[model samples]
Every structure is written in structure tokens, then in C-alpha cells.
Target: MDFRPVLHILMRIVLITAVSLLMCVPVALIYHEPVSPFLYTSLIATILAACAYGGRGKQELTTFKRREAYLSVTLSWLIVSLIGALPYLFSGAIPGITDAFFESVSGFTTTGSSILTDIESLPKSVLFWRSMTHWVGGLGIIVLVVIIMPSLNIGSYNLFTLESSFQEKIHPKIRSVGRRLLYIYLSLTFIETFFLLLGGMNLFESLCHSFGTVATGGFSPKNTSIGDYSPYIQYVITIFMLLAGTNFVVHYYAVKGQFRKIKQNEELRFYYKVTFVAGIAITAILFFQTDRSLETAFRESFFQVASIITCTGFATADYLLWPSVGWVIIFFLMFFGGSTGSTAGGIKMARHLVALKNVKHHFRILNAPNAIIPLRINSKPVSAQDNNGILTFILWYFMLFLGGSLLMAWLGSDVPTSLSSVATAMGGIGPGLGSVGPASNFAHLSDSSKYVLCGMMLLGRLEIYTMVMLFNPWFWKN
Candidate 1:
């Protein structure tokens, strides 16, 4: 391992954490909450950062290679999670280290899964930090760091590409692209928060929900999530959630006043179509099976469907308590995540699109053996490498999904709960079916199972390849 690259990234991350903690201190003080521990933690982080980077001047820092990029990305997350856990731990709200780390990881991963049973009871400052973690993490730490650190500009692209989702590349200039993405992200959050406030939520609630929605993290201040809000609030969130799950590049085009690009983008079109069809199917099921009014049923049905499908995992109602068919619909939607390059996680819509096209192409080739067939997406011929990468990613993802489920089952969860929990965690979707459903938290799971799910969340968030490659002996041999 090249310790220099690792140390360099670690120092950068620590510096970021220290700054974050320092920023949070005044908020804590404003709320009249204890701030000593937060300040102490910041000092510790600052000292550690200084020690790591002080000896070697900035001139000694070199460009990171691909392998180093992977290591840096993975290590940065781990370090951030570990350090991020300090506020929770020092605040004495969550005593257990593992639970604190879990919450921290959930926040940074934007998975929005929380072990905390009572969210509103926490201090406002702590809640702000929690929500802020989602906001910062939504775009990504590396991307954030890359934008600020001018010296690392040469190789920042490789790190950004490796860290982001399959379809999230903004432009050739890393800093410029990062800044544009950040602006778009912040604008969306501000707009959503404003709308939520107008829809009757308070500023705090609106801010928290905005953080969750924009990040697609789903860490609501209220335990009932969007279910506690009015129809207007839910509707506002639904639109934003849909936006959050889309490729930001599409949003960029829209922002640049390119209305035709938005209309012409095949992924965006398919995304809305899928949400519409799924919403209709789910709403119909809820109406027929449950006693809810059409308006209510449609609202709840579409909200939960959009939430889960986008991997946002926010809930208007506990779908687990719904009829069997409703449960099954949600189960299937767990695999159909939002568009690539979005904050949402899961097997992305683009991959599913490519996979479906590949299936049709195979059938065509079988029928006419002599025909030249190439898989196409958006009227463009798909490259063999991209196709293989998608296929391999899906295969590995499912294999791990099944394997994780069985392993969790062995650790004492039932088959259904275990399988769904693994799928949800691995997909970076917060809720699952059976016992581990939206109404329940992961606090009941065995320590082993929690650790397993944590690994799964990391694997899912990193898009499988970067994490998997680190395990390959070849990654270390050179």
C-alpha cells in the first residue's frame, strides 16, 4: 500500500471533519446544548490532521493513481464515519460506539437508515449535524474535497469518477463540474425546504426533511416520516424525490435552459414512465385491497413506491401492514432504483434498461443466427465493455444479496426478513419487508448481522466494483 496517498487523503478528511465539527459547535451553543465535547473532538481531529500533513509540505503531495483512488475513497469514508460518530458519542445521546458509527455511516452513505427510535427527542444541533451529514454526503466528500483542494486537481477526475455512480459525470473540468453540481444540489435543497415550509412544516422540520429528500437519505425528524405531514408536503417531497433520483446531468441541462435536452434524454423519460406505471399499479392495489379513500390511497401508494423505487426509503405508511400484493410490489421495486448519477441507490434504472435491451437482443440473435445485433440504448449502440460491466455488477450484487440474506438468517433473523433486510441494506434502501420493515429499526439485529449490513451498504454505495477490486490480490501485487 502507498501510505503517502492514504495519509494525504486521511489528513484531508480529518481537516474536513474538524471544520465540520467546528461549524457545528456554534449551532450547539445556540441551542444551549453542551459544546465542549464537540470542540474537543474538533481539536483532536485538527491535531491529527496537522500531524499527518505538517511534516511534508504541500509540494510533496503527488497525484493519486487509480488504485490509490480506490483506497483513498474507501478509507476516506471509513475515516469520516469513525470521526463523524464523535458528535453522537460525545453528546451522550447514543452511548454504544457501534450504534453511533452505524448512524454516522448511514448519514454519510445517505442510506437514511437509523437505529434511533425517537428522532425528535435529540438536540437540535445534533439533528442539524445528522441532516448536514446527509447533505454533504449526498454529493460526496471526495467531490467536495476535490472542488476545494486546487493542488489535487490533476488526478481529482479519477477519484471523482471512481467514487460517483455510473452515469454522474458532469464535465471535463473537475472543479468547475463539482461547483456546478454543488450549486444545483444546494438550490434544490433550498427550494424543497421552502416548499415544505409553505406546506405547513416548521423551518427545522423543513430543513431536516429537505436534507433527507435532496440526499434521498430519508432521515426524517419525525419518526412517522412524511406520513406525519399534509398531502401538500407529501406531494412536494414526491416531486423533489423524483428529481433527487434523476441524473444531475439532466438537471444541469435543464438549469442551462436546455429544455429540449431534458425532453430528449431517454433515461429521464423512462424514469418518469416507470414511476407513473408503478405508481398506478401500486395505487390501484391499495385502493382495491385497503379501506383508504382514492386520494389517500393514491398519495400513500405513490409516495412509498417512489420512495422505495428511488431507494429513498421514506414512508407515508407502513407498507408492510398493507395487503400481500402491496408487499410484493414494494419487494420488486427494491431492485429498480433511480437513474444513474442521482443520489438514490440500488441497481440503477440505466442498468435495468441496458439489461432489458440485452435480453431482447439475445432473443433476436437466437431467432436469426446470421444477423448482426448490437444492444442499443437511447438509439446509441451499447459497447460490449459497458454491457459486460453492467451484467457483472448485477450478478455480483445479487450474489452478495442472497449470500448476505442467508448469512443474516443464520444469525437468527427469519428467511423473509433476512432476505429483504440484506436486499434493502445492500441496495442502500432503508426499509425492508417482514420484521425489518419501515415501522421497525435495525436495533434488534444481532451485532454480526449489523456489521454484515454495514459492509453491504458500503458495497452498494461504492457501486460494487471499487470495493471488490480492493479485495483482489492483483490490486495489491504491483
Candidate 2:
């Protein structure tokens, strides 16, 4: 690994982050809040960026290898997150480093997990900055996965391909894809913001929620989450959440009016089917088992279904109060994340589809050993390598989940809280079951537990392999 190239690139990210911190100053002024928090933080970050600059020359980037790529990607997220914590610290909102770092990691990772119990009481600038983290992190992952990871084929193997027979024929150049994804990203944010405004949400709340929605990051300004909003407002956020969670290539094709390509997206179909079924099932239970009206049942069920499936953590109702079967469905759905290339996090729809196909293929083979049961997605037979990659990803996903749960339990969280907190953290889904449920925040958890969740967030955001491989001694030995 060329340490110079990695550090050089990281310094650039820090510089960019420093400049972004200044975006908060206006909000501070608008509300008569202290501007020193953001200014001081920006200056601190700028100085740190200067110190991090290796000045070993830009040509080293040409020699950047897979190891350097891995390190660069991991460190990029880490250092920005560390710097992102400065606003909270400077403002004295979250006084402790561990809690501030945890919130920052949650924000940058788009996990939406919060340690802030009184979200609305915070300075408007801080809340605005928090939501901005979601928006920034969302675009960051989209660019990283859609552009950079395809070059590191393994990192993106389970995601959409480079103009595959099944994939939309979007250009694969870094600039081309990056610019186009940015267009779609900004379009979603702005359009959602407009609609939230139409629904009578004030500008500040609208922008913040729109940021959360479009990013699939569920950091709402209100302490009640979306529960405080009207049905129209909640529906607006829900619709955009689904759109944001859809594969961005689908958005590109649809923008070009290529409806045919979208029709052929198996993962898209699977995503819709899963959402529909889960929503209907939960709606039925809420209607039958509770006293809520039919429309309320429908609204609560679908909003939650979209939220959990997309890894957006917005809440209109607490499902932990629902029947066992209802909340249990929500719990299991944590593993079935949204599309791979999109910002939504978890095991993803592609892996779940592949896992199901494997099961059906095996059952058919047992019925007739000689019958050729070729597994396929999007009408093309999946390669053995890709098949194994997705399966291995799911396997390791659960393995890490189990190991993390055990560690959380050891860190003194009870069984249900430990399991669900780790599950939500890894999936980039905010709320979990037990003490960490939708109504609860992560503030009560020990600092050790918060750090553990932070590790899970990074691991999940990088799709487990890129960051996890850095721990391998052979990676360095080679």
C-alpha cells in the first residue's frame, strides 16, 4: 500500500469537509445561534487537513493499488466522520467525544441512529448540519459504489454491472456516472423538498426532512420523528424514500424515458414485491389487532415498511407496541435492505433474491438430478462467481451480526436490546427492538456499545468486505 497516495487523498476530503462546515454558519445567524461552533470547527478541520497533507506528489495516485483503494475508501469515511463531530462538540450539545463520535458516525454512515433525546431543543444549525450529513453521506456512497467500486469489481459485484445485458446501458466513466448520479441525487432532494413545502411543512423542516428522505437517512428535526407531521407530509417523505431507495440507474433510464429497461429490472421488481407484501401484512395486523382506523393502519404499516426496507429510520408509529407477529416482521425485514447501488443499507434485495433462487434451484435438483436448473436474474444466467459472492456476502453479514450481538451483550446490554441495536447499526437502520426501539434513543447505551455500533455502521456501509479485509494480516503480507 502506498501510504502517501492514501493520505494525500484523505487530506483532500478533510479540506472539502472543512469548507462544507461553513454551510452551517448562515443557519446559525438566521436563528441568532452562536456561529463560533461552526467557525472554530471549520478552522480546526482546515488546520488538520493541512497537517494531513503528505505533499508526496499527485503522481502517486496513478500508482494507487487495490490495497490503497481499500485504505483510502475506509479512511475517507472515518476521518470525515471524526471531523463531522466537531460541530456537536463545539456547541456543547453533545459534550462527550464518544457520544458525539457515535452521532457523527451514524450521520455520515446514514444510519440515523441518534443519541440526542431532545432533538428539537438543539440549535437549528446543528439539526440542519445533522441532516446535511445524511444528504452528503448518501451522495458519497452513491458515487463511491456506483463509480469507484465497479473498478474494484469485487466491491460492486453484487451491485449493478458495467452495462450488462440485464443492466441499463448507462455510461461507466467516473465523471459521467458521478455527474449523472449527482443530478439524480439533487433532483430527489429538491423535488421532495418542494412537495414537503406544498404539504405545508415550513422551509427549514421541509429541507431537513427532505435531506433525510432523499438520503434514506431518517434524522428528523422533531423528537417525535414523522409522527408529529400530517398524513400528507408523511406520505410525501414515504414516496421519496422509495424513490431514493430504488437503483439510481433506474432513475437515469426513466429520466431518459426508457421505460423498457426499468421493466426488466428483477431487483426492482423484487424490491416492490417485498415492500408490497410486507406493507399489506402489517396493515392487516394493525387493522385487525388494534383499534386504529383503516387509513391509519395503512399509513403506519406502509410508512414503516418503506422505512425499514429502505433503511430509513423515520417513524410515524411505534411498532414495538404492535402485536408480536407485526413487530417481528419489522425485525426480520431489517436484513432485507433496499437496492444495492442505492444509499439504503443492509443485506440488500439482490442478495435476498439470489439466496431465494439458490433455495429453489436446490429443491428442483433434488426432484430431478439431471435437470438443468440455471439460476438467473434479469433473464441472464448468473455466473458462479457472482452467485458465490452474493451468498458469501449474506453469510458474512449474519456472521458479523452474530458476533457483534454477542459483543454488545458482553458490553452489558440485555439480549433483545443488544441484538436489535447491533442489527439496526449494521443495516444503517436507526431504531431497533427492546430498549433501543423506535421510541428510544441510543443515549442510554454505554460508550463501549456506541463505539461497537460505529464499527458496525462502517462495516455495513462498505458492504463488509472493503473495511473488513484491512484486518487481514495477509493483506499487508502480500
TM-scores, all models, native as reference: 0.91, 0.96
Backbone clashes in each candidate structure, one number apiece? 0, 0
Highest-scoring model, TM-score: 2
lDDT of 1 by residue, 307-402 (tens): 987788788899888888888988988988887768888887877777788889999999999999888765656667667767887888899998
TM-score of 1: 0.91
Name model 2 segments beyond 4 Å from true.
51-56, 60-63, 156-162, 165-172
Off by over 4 Å in 1: 55-62, 141-172
- For model 2, give the RMSD to the true fold: 2.0
Residue 234 lDDT, candidate 2, scale 0-100: 84
Error of 2 at 64 (Å): 3.7
lDDT accuracy of residue 451 in candidate 1? 84
Global local distance difference test of model 1: 0.78
Please list all clashing residue pairs in model 1, or write none if there are none.
none
- Cα lDDT tens digits, model 2, 68-156, are 88899899999889989989999998999999999999999999999999998999999999998898889888877766676667544
